[model samples]
Target: MSGLAASERSVRPSSGLSRFAAMFGKELLELVRSLKLIWVPIVFIALGIMQPVTSYYMPVILEKAGNLPDGSVIEIPLPTGAQVMAETLAQFGSLGALVIVLVFMGTVSSERNSGAVSMILVKPVSPASYLVSKWGAMLLLSSLSLLAGYGAAWYYTGFLIEAVAFKAVLSSFLLYELWLLVLLTLTLLLSTALRSAAGAAFAALGAGAVLSLLSNLFPKYAGWLPGALPGFARQAVMGSLEWSSRFGACLVATVMLLAALVLLANILLRRAAAID
Candidate 1:
């Protein structure tokens, strides 16, 4: 009888792993069949090309607009290559946030609404694995989107400018992408917690604004906010290797925020399972 119990226990783990793989594969196939795989990459690619293209010509456009009022000559400083790259990065990065929200809005929330979660759960999958697989999907897509955007920026910037260091450029671009992971994680938290997809998206956006407002309210603690992602990205692009206390603060906050998001998602998923 004891031997039989041990065999049964081992079988349970094997079954659980099988469920995990099934859940992961099903979600991946859904993404592909639904054209999510197509549009997400397309959106980021458009932004990537647009960013560098705009930056390359923006200075020219501004200069053509020429001097301003009071008969004072508007001295347009010649745009440096780094500054131009920064300008493109700024626009690309902002759009990256919106892309994350749109891409993830329906990641889990819609699954819940469409009764798809019920369908999957009936197949012996755990809610924890379900939630995790959704997060994994978001992270995977976001990473690819960032890479496409970075590749575009590199190509455009290289074509227009000389002496661009590949290492610095790639590092800066990657920092922007990592910060975006923070945003993706935040959205996952909201989507999991809220039953409504729209509600989840709005909540994530509102949370972003709140974090921004808090940065101003508690200036000293700004590094700890999600808003700090963009700032850190900027600093990283500029090659600030300084081991400032603020860097440590930003690192800690990013990790903590991600952890909180994961925990919240798991809790909500558990509640969801209990209801089922």
Candidate 2:
């Protein structure tokens, strides 16, 4: 009896780890097999290249255009290396976030719709565990996409500007990943709330747009909201020493969002089981 108990204890940890791994592995396989994963890297790489190239050449292009007539006159300032990096990050990083959201549009909703959620439940997996595994898978994919963007940015920016700070560049890139998680959490909540994949995606996109518009209009004055979080993260990674408030606010909001999603997911799973 003593030997059996000892063996059981030793096996428990390994069993738990294996379960998490199994869940993570299943999601990973699905992610790789999906064509949407292909677009994440491609879009980010394109943005990385375009940002530096555009920054380096925009001034020259404007110079060639020369002075315009009084009615059409507009001054185009030469973009500094930092400014270029910031602009590039904003455009490409946001694009990457959107791509991640779209790719994950069906993460949970599809499973529920296709009756795969029911199948998963029969396999000794709890709904919470399944949702967590789905989140883990999305996080992994987002990390890879961000890495691609970071590598491309480093190569292009290093070539374009000799004095670029590697640490700063990395921080900016990491911030982008956090932003990805924030959006992913928001979408996860929507996926749980909506029965249709299209409905979830549209709801998430609409919420994202509204948050963005509000943040752009209010800046520091805006309350602790999802839209404010990404901006704070971006500013911090960009070495904005004064952006701590924004970063903190974003982090806090992200945590709250995840907590809310956990509650919602549980409710959905209960409802699903009831229906079954």
Candidate 3:
């Protein structure tokens, strides 16, 4: 009997993993059908290219404007490659984050409202599998989009501006990607917790804004928060960041918070399925 029980325990995890893969595949197919896989990366790449291009051409752009006097000289100092790359990430922090939130805002709630989740729950599928599948898909999408965008920005910055160290760019990318992950996870959590997709998006974005505001207003206190990630990313690019012990603490805290949110989302989704 002990041998049988042990065998059953081993089988359970394999089955669960299969279910998660199936669900993740379905989400990926849906993303493709919705053209999210195409347009999102395109948008990100556009935003990335815009940053370095605009930075490189600022003087020309200013001179082209009709308001400039004939003898006026625009001697604005050009930003370094690292600075340009940091500015590119700033684009992602604002508009790119919004795009991500809006795209996945309906990931779970829409299915719940449409009875799709009910259909799935009626089967033997685990709620944890369902939530994890959604999270995994979003993570893939976020990582791919950000990588494409940041790579483009890095290339442009090197070509137009000075060359930034690859190590610096990579470090900054990882840090900023963490910030994106937190925002994406927050949106997913909100989607499970709220019925309205718009409400979920608004709440997530609002929370992000509040975090950013607090971090900016009180850097000494809020430096350990996830909101300070962008600052850390910038510092990485500029090679000015001291590898503080708190940096690891903040990373761990952010990850723990994300895990808690995912767990809560799973529980809420299970309850929602029962109610339906």
Residues 1-276, candidate 2: write the lDDT tens digits: 999999998766445556768988988888778754777788888887888787777766666676755466446665556666777767754676667788888888888888888887876667777888888887888888778876786677768864457777777677667667767877887887788877787788777778767877887676456676556545654567364666577668767877787778777876785575
RMSD of 2: 5.0
Full-model lDDT, candidate 3:
0.89
Select the stronger candidate by lDDT from 1 and 3.
3
Candidate 1 structure quality by residue, lDDT tens digits, 1-276: 999999998766566767777778877898798887888778777876776566667666665675644455445444555555566667665676776786687778787778877777776677788877777787777778777866776677677753356666776776666677766777888887778877777788777767756764776867567666556555555566466777678678877887788888888877875574
Deviating ranges (above 4 Å) for candidate 2: 1-14, 35-38, 59-77, 219-223, 243-246
Query: Relative to the unseen true structure, what is the Cα RMSD of model 3?
Result: 4.4
Q: What are the lDDT scores of the predictions, listed in order?
A: 0.71, 0.73, 0.89
lDDT per residue, candidate 3, 68-103, as tens digits? Answer: 879988798999898898899899999999999999
Greater TM-score among 1 and 2 belongs to: 1
What is the TM-score ranking, best to worst?
3, 1, 2
The positional error of residue 249 in candidate 3, measured at the CA in angstroms, is 1.8
Instruction: Report the lDDT of model 2 for residue 259.
Output: 76
Give the top-scoring candidate (lDDT): 3
The collision pairs in model 2 are none
